[model samples]
Target chain A: MSQLKTKHLLGIKNLDREDIELIFQTAANFKEVINRPIKKVPSLRDVTVANVFFENSTRTKLSFELAEKRLSADVINFSASGSSVKKGETLLDTVNNILAMKVDMVVMRHSSPGAPHFLAKHIDANIINAGDGTHEHPTQALLDSFSIQETCGQVEGKKVVIVGDILHSRVALSNIFALQTLGAEVMVCGPATLLPKHIRELGVKVETDIKKALEWCDVANILRIQLERQQMKYFPSLREYSNYFGVNKQLLDSLKKEITIMHPGPINRGVEITSDVADSDHSIILQQVENGVAIRMAVLYLLAGVT
Target chain B: MQKRLLFDSPLLKVTISRLCQQLIEVHGDFSQSVIIGMQPRGIYLAERIKEELESLVAKDIHLGYLDTTFHRDDFRRRDEPITPSQTKIPFLIENKNVILVDDVLFTGRTVRAALDAMNTFGRPAKVELLVLIDRLYSRHIPVEANYVGRKVNTIQSQKVLVELDEKQKEDHIWLITKEE
Candidate 1:
């Protein structure tokens, strides 16, 4: 009967330390499951899950689908473009229609900040927020911490610096909440305009200089520049943002200690990070992607209670 | 809180030693064999048996651990979520004799899940079951252990508790009757 306290994984801020540990520990088991010769389990065979993406995604959608399929669940994929939502139907109507088909879980990514949270309140099925606007991407944070735990042995007592656009990146907020809850010291490094207001209130320090931030941390989770979310130019241009906070090999090699690098992907190469740094040994980007499936599987499996 | 002691440490130790001797007689130096303990509680018995076998035969045996939390048949139908245990199998069991160890064999559903979970690693040459206690007539599946420490018959409302030295002050077996 040991399970997560929360019914819905809306945000990392809603979870405590033990919940995060429970997730990471469960993910360790799923990681072993995926590494086996036959990488499928009949855990959710009797259950059905729907991936409802109101926002466009590449990695997140594919990762959720693969995770659900690997768990042997009946999966239904719905994209916003061709779905009833694009035909002037409300969010609730579209979701209720999906629910009427007897879906046990819904994994959603939306352009609104509290879309999943709102849907969770009105719906009976389990809700997992894949990414909710610029508010939170809980699974990315979970997988990031999971991958860091796999690399550094543990997350507690380690220094993690999230670099780049904080205001427009949901990944940064979730990572901050997750890392801080797990007892890791977190710092945000980026341009002042790109940073969120009152971010220091989150119990993390702000370092505008990327070099100093990289030098003082055990891991740097470099966020990609969310160009689609940018309405006006946050900084002067992409060139200025790259000059200020972009992580490249030369900048990484200049540091005194070697740190693990991570990025929640769909990377804008040569802008937020160079190709060499993304593909370097210091980077765990691909591992993050691989761990994404295990983490999502753990989330879905935990939510789908055991008999 | 009502409990009845079935076996104490001295008797349990003797029974485990007997099981180890039986394993050695069947598996012989255990070079072409592997021992996989069901995770959580069964690991304690598996470790104890491994230690006894090594001491009796003066040879090391390959040991592995398997967790069947995610492979259960009734996972989605349960009222509460089930937390998973770690699965660690460092060596491949392909074409090798495999011994699946557990503390008690009750419904035999766990053994069935273990069999399903083992397919991911590789096909074993053969698989045998070992348990400290066998609950008579309680098996939902037709699983019978190759080596058994003891067998007992119980009603539907009773539960068997196996306390190991790893988690308790001493090793003992208990049968508890739930109060109405």
Candidate 2:
């Protein structure tokens, strides 16, 4: 029996080295289980999980749902589009009502930063922060780290460079913390405006040169240029962004060593990464998606396993 | 920890030889069979048995490993997360005699979980349990090993420890009693 010190998986910052290691080790098991002929496990048969997405999602929602189903958990999905939240219902009220239905766990993806954290303090049921604003997507970081380790052998002593949208990307924040905790030398590379003001405070080297970063890194977790979250034009145009920070095959091949490419997708293909580079053997984007389910399964399994 | 000596090295070698002879008599070259060891400690015992069997029968046997962490009934009710091990049942068990090997058989919960785990890799024609030591009267699910090395009477608080020559310096068995 391996117990996590924290009750809720709110952020990567809240988790220690052992917590991350345990999650990865557990995810390794689930990864094996998912690859089997019969993918489903009877670990969470009696447990019920509620996925409360206050924002729109394609991958995270489906990945969490698949993970819940594979664990044999009773899944009740509550998207804001069809929920009481659209009817001016309070976050607490809606979640409390769901808890009244005997849901044992809540997997939430909110648009507001600290939304899941606030809910975790109030809710009796365990909360897994799917993606909360520009805060932290712990599971995404976990899966990304897991995928990196799976590909490059280990995260320790490896150079991991996160390219594009560091300021607005929750994945960047989480990945930086996770990779650093696992002893990976982490770097943030993007346009100066897209990078956070206090980005260096996160203990990651800030690299504006994509080629330099890519050349140094063993794994490059490229983030999609967030067009939706932009309030104003941070950069001149999409074309300019692509010209400057975009990862393409030509630039990758010029490097001495082949680096593993990753993207938390809905990729602006030509903008951050080209289609050819994304589909190349060096790219592990699909593996990241596959590892996402395993990582989420590990989180749900461990959290639910707690008596 | 207080330890009482049970079967020692010489007795262990004889018992293992006897077990292999019995398996040879029953399985007969083991063409339609696969041996799966319940991990993590069971693997050592399974390897030793496979070694003994191969030397006696003059043929290689299919050996697999199973981890029952995810298939356990007490999964969600446990105090902490159950760390699962490698479950490498490479060959299909469909319509084959599957031998579930373990170091010890006590409450039978592990064997029950192994059965559940085995169901994923297609249905076997038949399944049998083989244990190095079977503690009598401790059965929780009425599981009886077809091939057992030794049968011992144990109290509720007592524990059985089987150390193989592959890992330990010497092959030995110990019945451990807790301090008051």
Candidate 3:
């Protein structure tokens, strides 16, 4: 299985173990390429990609743009804030307009779930779902798993606990799918209100206690508490949430063994995780950022081969 | 399919030594030169040559592996997806002579891609091609190896296979022709 099975990267749920392995293997090569003096490649030189973000993003957007540029693809970024979407242009119309301009690929992030899937059915170009509301961020999960594999030697059999709001986090959802597919034991640790009702149906262990979850896992992937997505309060307050569920150096140090730490960024320094733990030696937060580029490159490169 | 032995183990060993000798004669201790092997199959030849050259010249010759999967012109055109190997060039090629090594030079496309791949790692003072098997009259691009092991005339249906093994005695080069 040298090639990816699917044409578009809509979600990790659509991928099998072989696809994930191929992406990681290819990403390993891209990782080496990005570390070189000249970090750019001519692979996607003839391909044009449009980064159509229906929502705002910082790291994912920058990472995708950097990955596209490094692959030598011509990129045009579109955000919803100032776009024709504000003028009541439909999603299909906006994408069709971009496609008419001869765009070969679209990396889209929409506020609604399955937006990329919707566009995939209508558009001829390849569609990479950057983030579709609370659905999934495939690249983030891939890079997170890649980082784990890089650090701990493998993702198989390792205990990885995702610590934070799982309901509103596309990162958590994608991470669970990717980690499980790669044969890792996954556990979601957060307050009861933040976790979705049927999260156990996804086959991951659920734990409301942060310390017990920390003690049981080899790696902890801390997620940000999305205040913007919360219309009503899930937890009492930020201070109380931090008091119960926050991961700090004291909590980590209290563990029986030193476990690897991870956080998909825009980290709440003292809210979900403290400054010391975020910047600690156990943290692979920064490496995740770097791996994001390589993972995205591997995805774009592989999908470009589909036609 | 028909297979013909182009070079046996003994011949391969002698050819490699001769190639290393020619390299030593030109590079002269390789103080300002680096050997870069094209990825996938080329690294084996590059490793063998680097080992032979170091022992012959009694100098540590810097060697690197380069993958041209990203630079290939036939990228979306090929039926099978091109998988990239690792590119491990630790040192910069600035103002240094680069000897690009490969096992087979057939369509000249891999070498062309290698040329583009090598350019990313600074500008080399001089770049030279070294191939174990040169498939004559089969180039799609203008690429000629500086050090050629054996030039064998081949048709479009013919393929050159250079097998370099850990056990040096098992090394053999074969010309395979597809029979319809």
Highest DockQ against the true fold, candidate = 2
Q: List clashing residue pairs in candidate 2.
A: none
Individual DockQ of the candidates? Answer: 0.67, 0.79, 0.75
User: DockQ (C-alpha) of model 3?
Assistant: 0.75
Any runs in candidate 2 off by more than 4 Å, and if so which?
A: B167-169
List the lowest-lDDT window of 10 residues for candidate 3 chain A. Answer: A1-10
CAPRI-style quality class for the chain A–B interface of candidate 3: medium
Model 3 lDDT per residue over A112-192, tens place = 999999999988899999999999999999999999999999999999999999999999999999999999999999999
Every model's TM-score on chain B = 0.95, 0.94, 0.97
On lDDT, who's better, 1 or 3? 3
A60: Cα error in model 3, Å: 0.6
Estimate the Cα RMSD of every predicted model relative to the unseen true structure. Answer: 2.1, 1.3, 1.0
lDDT, candidate 3, equals 0.94
Question: Docking category for candidate 1?
Answer: medium
| TM-score: model 2 vs. ground truth | 0.98
Candidate that would win on lDDT: 3
Q: For candidate 2, give the lDDT of residue B114.
A: 91
> lDDT tens string, model 1, B1-180?
689887788888889899988988988889999999998789988998888888888888888999988788877566776667888999999999999999989999999999998988999999999999898989888989999999888777789987787743487799999989
Candidate 1: segments with Cα more than 4 A from true spot: B166-169
